[model samples]
Target: MHRKTIVDVGTDHGLLAIGLALTGKFQKVIGVDVSQQALENGALSLLSQIESRRKGIDPQKAALDVPVEFRHGDGLKALEEGEADIVCMAGMGVSTLLQILEQDHDALTSDLNRRQYTDLILQPTNSKPRNLMFLYKSLQDSGWELRNERIVKLSSRWYVTSHFTRPQSNIPVTALIEDGAMKIPGSTLDCTLSDSDPMRQDLEEYCRHHSQWIRKDSEYGRMDLLEEVWLERFGNDR
Candidate 1:
């Protein structure tokens, strides 16, 4: 069994970390941010959340003593080698996320990574298909296999949250990437949900330009379509 610890890198308000802690699935949650101010704010939020939960009627929820800590540092510099089983980098751009990983490759790309395995929850704020494709391609080339994928349109910006983990030795890297484009299933681009709004119009143009080369296949190219849930996933259902 593995240690059920999570390290939230670039955790802005620690909402995701707090939510994970509340689920009681993870034993510990660490919110790491570059800005000290952000850490302070998240600490306050965590404190307030705990206090509020303590006042609730659900004794079990209130009694949940999941530890949530905040650290101040850029990217993965605040993290030690194999410090957590899961690392989340959300609400960031594709380029910024890649830069962070590139800056601290050894810590994440260790032999321990293959043996112990680490889950990475990456949600990029970038809307351009080309950039997202680049990030996806980079992850594959670096031996991170996709476990889950989500496409969300939050307040005019489309976000793709890719959950990845250590590559299984048997499976080969993705061959879908071709001619700067591949197919991304269950997306506005794939399903043709294009509208005429100015922002979406711009995104639509880019999607059209790279439609052939930017492929984010459905849940690792699963055969059965789970249209009931709006997530595009791969690997295990969890």
Candidate 2:
């Protein structure tokens, strides 16, 4: 746990922000959403959780005193530069996430470059391979390196969660981007993944489950990522 301020983008219920606040890992947590209704609902839920979690404790040292704030706005537009140390956007489709990044590139890139916000956590709610790859490429091209990535199963569903950082962090690479699909130079997807790469297996599994979207779609990059990963991991070589 680190002493940092985290802004949870698209925080529908504010559960993640609240849970993190309870851990004492973060000093403050701000939840931002476009829908005022979601923010109100999340605020009510936070109040309920605070009331239930704070019995027999001094009002000054409550368990839920994590300084969680809720703001209504569209994505990063809700905050000023250097306002937060980290930004977490969960439960969004890759396409939707990409759109937000595209629209918020000015703010996002500025904060990341200034090292005001070091970590960006993106978890696409859906399992669309092409959209994920496109997002990966877009971020890489924009200078954010994928520092950590995980594929986890939750209640019979598998999702990919990625942690990106500016190159200033100097962290060793855990996820390798090899193998070209749409020519995003300097991308994690620029070369072929080696057997030692950790993401190989997860990419294979993701591709296997996403076979249903094999149909062509040019705007979305079609099945290029899916087929490439399939061929690289489970294809003729295997």
Q: Pick the candidate with the highest lDDT.
A: 2
Report the lDDT tens digits of candidate 2 across residue range 144-200: 777666666668577777788764433212223453322221124324556566656
TM-score of 1: 0.65
Q: Supply the global lDDT for candidate 1.
A: 0.61
Model 2 spans with C-alpha error above 4 angstroms: 56-60, 105-115, 167-222, 225-230, 233-238
CA displacement after TM-score superposition, residue 35 of candidate 2 (Å): 1.5
For all candidates in order, the CA lDDT equals 0.61, 0.65
**Which digits, one per residue and each the tens of the lDDT, describe model 1 over residues 1-238?**
4448888878887788777776767888888888988767766566676757676756665434756777888867777766777778888888888888767456435543633547778887765544665676666655666666555555655666677777544222244343312234224233343355444554444444333222344335532222211233222122
State in Å the error of residue 215, model 2: 10
- Candidates in order, TM-scores: namely 0.65, 0.72
Each model's RMSD to truth, in Å? 10.1, 6.2
Off by over 4 Å in 1: 1-3, 52-64, 105-108, 111-117, 169-238
The residue pairs that clash in candidate 2, if any, are 177-188, 178-191, 179-191, 179-192
Candidate 2 to truth, TM:
0.72
